[model samples]
Target: MKNILIVGGSKGIGNAILLQQLEQNKVYNISRNAPEVTHDNLVHFSLNVLEDALPEIESIDTIIYCPGSINLKPINSLSIDDFRNDFEINVIGAVKVIQKYLATLKKGTNPSIVLFSTVAAKLGMPFHASIATAKAGVEGLVKSLGAELASAVRINAIAPTITDTTLAAGILRNDRMKENMVERHPMKGYLQATEVAGMADFLISDKAKSISGQVFEMDYGIVSFKI
Candidate 1:
């Protein structure tokens, strides 16, 4: 079985990914809160991605960085600190964690790294300036690092649009709001946390050994086509 490290695996897509891989993999979850789901193979590290030190572990076959922010505000309303906070959490935090564990990842079997982005990074959503800018940096990190570490490790990213998660509770709280989001996607359905988790599973598996430096947009057609 592989040893999988999931940053921010306590909730949302990260939690789902932790659960998905528990049956056959040794999973390490690093986040501020403890994970809701318990498994024999799961190890939870209670720490903030931005501040705390990661547990000393080696031979990580895969890492899925799932921590993100969804601060939707118009560009004019966004403060300088807002942009900085988003970049710190979404980009800097991931980079720091990965840098710390890169050696361990190199020693693992077909090691792969997965990071998250947003459809807004490419689609130019009106009120997504902060997060889009941050995730766009994440996308760039995936490509540059994917190439830099190509011989030993594979790095990639997933860009999803308006996923149904606690982080997005404000957007999907009401029927009207939910309907508006669904209608924006050609598929007429938004992404679920578990579905995104499944995609993460695929990316790190042997099936995706040849795939790296790419951002897979799981936007339900919101950023790709018109309904």
Candidate 2:
């Protein structure tokens, strides 16, 4: 069994991943809030990735940074603080966690790091400037750090389109809104939180050992097709 450290594992994709892996892996859930469910193999730690320091972990086989922000606004309407906040949560927070646990991760068995990105980073979407900018930086981190730690660890990211989660409740509230979202993607379905979490699970598993520095676009064809 491996030891996994997931920042922002309290809810949404992170929470789903925590639940899926806790049965076999020793998982640490660090976030401002604790997970809704608890297990023997699951440990909870309160943390604010943008503000607080992480607790020392013994050995981390996989590192998943899940803290993200969605401040969708036109470029002209968005203030500098909005960009700063997004960067702090989506980029700097992940950097802090990775830097803090780099030593422990290097000591693990085929260690890997998983980060979350957004399809908007690749596909141009109106009112997505803040999140897209932040996630773009995350993609860069995966590429640069993946190379820097190639011998010691693997790092990758998942860029999913609008997913069904509390964080996205505002966007998927009514059938009209949901339909509009589904219509945007060639695949006429919403991206589930579990599906994204499953990919994260795979990256950390031995099956994906050969993969690194890659950004998996789980965007349901948003970046590929116009239909």
Candidate 3:
């Protein structure tokens, strides 16, 4: 079994990916908090990607950074710190972790790294100023790194719209809110955590060996047609 290291693998899409990963490999989970789930194949490691460098990541075959923030406030309401915080966890934090584990990733068999972004980066929704700016940076990072890390490592990202995760509970708290969100897409619903995670698992698997530098969209038509 391959050794996979997933940062922030304790919840939501991260946790869903972890569950799928556990079915096939030894998974090292790096996160600030413990996952609500338990597993015998899991090795949990307390790691705040923004706080410290990864430990002995040289042994990890793949590393997926799930660090991100959803700051849905308007541009005027958002402070400079809001954008700063978004970029820190969304882009900078992921970079720091990847750099720390560069050697290990290079050591693995066709090492792959996955990062998360949001559909707002490309869709340009209101109240997404702070996060859209930050996730935009993440997109740039993924493209640049994918070019630089080629042959030895593959890099990709997924950008989804308003996934049904705790991070956006406020947006889906009631029927009115949920209905408004669902209507935004032709599919008329937000992505389930399991659904997005399944997409992620497919990317990391050997089946996607030739895939790299692509930003996969799982937005349920939010990024395109609504008809």
Minimal lDDT window, size 10, model 1: 50-59
Candidate 1 yields a Cα-based lDDT of 0.91
Candidate 3 vs. true structure, TM-score: 0.96
lDDT tens digits by residue: candidate 2, 1-227: 99999998898999988989999999998999989887999889986777777798897899999989889888999999999999999999989889999999999999999999999999888999999999999999999998999999999999988889999999999999999998877888879999998899899999999999999999888788875
Which TM-score value belongs to model 2?
A: 0.98
On lDDT, who's better, 1 or 3? 1
After superposition, candidate 1 runs with Cα above 4 Å error: none
Output candidate 3 Cα RMSD. Answer: 1.2
Q: Candidate 2 — worst ten consecutive residues by lDDT sum?
A: 47-56
Winner on TM-score between 1 and 3 is: 1
Give the lDDT ranking, best first. 2, 1, 3
Displacement of residue 24 (Cα, Å) in model 1 is: 0.8
- Candidate 3 residues lying further than 4 Å off, grouped into runs, are none
lDDT of 1 by residue, 1-227 (tens): 99999998887888888889999999998998999888899888888878777789966888889999999888899999999999999999999989999899889998999999999999977888899999999999999998899898999999988889899999999999999988888999998988998889899989999999999999888888975
lDDT by residue (141-196, candidate 3, tens digit) is: 98998899877898999998888888878888998998898898878788988898
Candidate 2 segments exceeding 4 Å error? none
